[model samples]
Target: MMTFRDKTVVFNAPKVMGILNVTPDSFSDGGQFNKLDDALKQTEKMIASGATFIDIGGESTRPGATPVTLEEELDRVIPVIDAITERFDTIVSIDTSKSEVMLEAANHGASLINDVRALSQPGALETASRLAQEHNIPTCIMHMQGTPETMQDLPRYNSVVDEVIEFFRAQIERLTANGFEYKQIMLDPGFGFGKTLDHNYEILKRFDEFTQFDLPVLAGMSRKSMIGNLLNKGITERLAGDICVNTVASLAGASILRVHDVGEAADVSKIIEKLNQINV
Candidate 1:
């Protein structure tokens, strides 16, 4: 269980974190929830569908995606964060790499900092450390081979699983040395961020290796090219693929499943819980 201020998220069973990309080009549901009302509506839908957390991203982190200015990212996400926290009782995760955005999101009531850059952006680590001390918020660090722009350009690893484990080790050590408690950290394997299709599947096959950290492992493969490219499907048609991958992830000990399809992912979690309860 992870506690943030007054919110406590129990991970005894995998939890579903709904994706809310409030950008114009996030590969899947971009420009769909940029507006405040639309964002709130989607938040309500996800919550009602059993989302334990709402992950709001301002900047598009898609491969080759253009970068949004800090002010633009703040403008895009803060108001939505404000609205969601005002209306919903769920935990809000700000998906940003900028220190300024993280500060503002925390001030406005975000409980988790889910940085795709894993706090590598300038001042991000310091800012997150301070936030962890001040607000008791947790951070989810993802492993990406390169920047979103160049990440997909022939990304390579000597051994994806071993390399990712090493990266997590270094990050955990760095974060702890910099004043973050172990309980305040989470890990994400970054399904498509900087990986080829084979690399992604390999990580999934070895997903349990991440559980060695004893921290929450987040699996966010909803509507990603990893699935669409593999099945020759479009973004909308990848629900079955998403559920399949998330099921595998849950079985492998993922504590959180970040997904666009919250209802389906929630059902997957329930099924996994029941299966785990089998006595025979």
Candidate 2:
């Protein structure tokens, strides 16, 4: 069970983390929920559909995307987070790499920190450690080869899975060194962050290798390029492919599936749990 604030999330099946991107340039669903009302409505729908967590992101971390200022990011996410917390009984995961945003979101009631950069940005580690201890929340540290802008340009890996595990090891050590318990950290292999089509699939095929750390594994393959470029399907049309990936990841021991569609992901979780129950 993962405890955050007053909420304790115990996942019998893979928990579906509904994606609520309040940005103008995310690869999928960008500019769709930038409004507070729309964001709340979406949050309501996802929670009603059985989302255990709501991942709210203010900045667009899409490859080649321009960066937003700290003020701009805060302006985009704080109000929506406040509204969601006021109205819903869901855990909000702040998807950011900025230390100030992390501190402010924690203050405003965010329950988890999900950073693509793994809290390596300037003061992020310090802030994250303090917040984890103060709020008693867990964090998701994702592995990326480089910055979003240049990550896809010339992505290479001696062994993608091994390198990612090593990255998680170093990150976990750093977080523990800064006073965070090992249980307070999770791992995300970052499907499309800096991987080619083959590299992404290789990681997915070897997803269980990460389970050796005994930490919850998060898979965020919803509508990523690995599916699109392989199947030639656009972002909105990748739901079928996304569901397939979610299923495989869950079967591979992913504890959390961060996805764009909560309803379908919930269905997948239920079915996978049922299938896993048979002791034949």
Candidate 3:
């Protein structure tokens, strides 16, 4: 199984994965951390805020997010990976499903492969499975209905919860048949990729259904279209909405909250976990 020095296993329990999108076109934090020096500073700050994992995304997977080739993706991410691995003693997750990117990241020092495509990119999943076995890296499998270019056109689901559960079951079977251990896997419901506002809310309301598999749930609703589109707000004006979404997600049993604002969300999680301990 994948392990960290601080006993922060990615798949076993709830953990905070702070987002560090080192790309120019990321939905929210693009161009913010693409600089090597800026990325290094942001990563260190995130670690100080109780983040267990640093999820670095070289490509923007936001709905209708433009695509980037493997070369561009690597050029954008490798330096950051090199810089972070050189400095931190924390687990760093590379958020990409491309096999080439995956292999390069494995070589560079990534411990988790958070794939939004769920590795459907022709041998991508299989490659990730093998890499996990080879490098002891855990993988987070997420469900997206369509390509990021067109996922928001007419996203539909008769019963999102059931369909997502089915997807997870099938994905798990695929990985298992490929010789992957269950302990090295995590699950993400992929809240805004191809869902309507209602579908997103439904997934959040029934988040516990995913916990049935006993896998850690990673939620990424921070500053997403689900919050601003629902509230008719802009990306720069969604802090309260983002915080509220994180609060609901944490309460709904999400093991990891992937957020853009690390320090604020870290404080919120601290207070909430404290109250939960009191109740326990």
Candidate 4:
């Protein structure tokens, strides 16, 4: 169980985290929820669809994506976060790597800090450490081979699974050394962040390996290029593939499913829950 603010998410069953990208170029569903009204509507839809967490990202981390300024990222996400906290009762995750952005979003009512850069940015670790100490806020540290701008430029790994596990092992040690408790940290293998088609599949096939830390593992393969590239499907046509991969992740012990289609992902969780309850 992970407690944030006044809420506790019991991971006895897998939970769904809806992706709400408040950016103009997030590769998929970018501009759809950048506006205040649209973001609220989508939040309502996702909550009603059974999303336990709504992940709001200001900057686009797509391959070859350009970086947004601190001011622009803050401006894009803070207002939406404020409105969502005021209106909804769901946990809000701030998907950013900026220190100032993490502080502002937490002040405005974000409970989870989902940093793809794994809080490696200059001041991000310090800021997040403070937040964790004060609010007991949890952070999800993902494994990315390189920066978003150049991660896909011929990505390579000596042993993807071992490297990711080592990365988590090192990161958890660093975060705990910096004052974060074991329960306050989560892990994401970072599908499609810096991996090729083969690398992504290898991680998926070995998804259960990440559970070694006993921390919650988040599988965020929703509408990612891994699915698109593998199945020869376009962005909008990858839902079936997304569901399949997420199902595999769930059975492999993923505690959280970060996805674009909340309703479908929720359904997947339900079926998996039922399966887990069956007698062998």
Candidate 3: C-alpha lDDT: 0.85
After superposing candidate 2, which stretches have Cα over 4 Å from the reference?
Answer: none
Stretches > 4 Å off in candidate 1: none
TM-score of 1: 0.99
Q: For each candidate, what TM-score against the reference?
A: 0.99, 0.98, 0.94, 0.99
Give the winner by lDDT: 2 or 4: 4
Report the lDDT tens digits of candidate 1 across residue range 9-116.
778789999999999888999889998999999999999999999999999999998788999999999999999988889999999999999999999999999999
lDDT for each of the candidates? Answer: 0.94, 0.92, 0.85, 0.95
**At residue 131, what lDDT does model 4 achieve?**
95
lDDT by residue for model 2 over 1-280, one digit each (tens)?
6788778877667999999999988889999999998999999999999899999999999999778999999999999989999998889999999999999999899999999999988999999999888878778999998898899998998999999999999988889999898889989999999999999999999998998998889999999999999999998899999999999899999999999999999999999889878898
How many pairs collide in each candidate, listed in order? Answer: 0, 0, 1, 0
* Highest-lDDT candidate: 4
| Worst window of 10 by summed lDDT in candidate 2 | 4-13
Question: What C-alpha lDDT does candidate 2 achieve relative to the native structure?
Answer: 0.92
Compared with the true structure, model 4 gives a TM-score of: 0.99
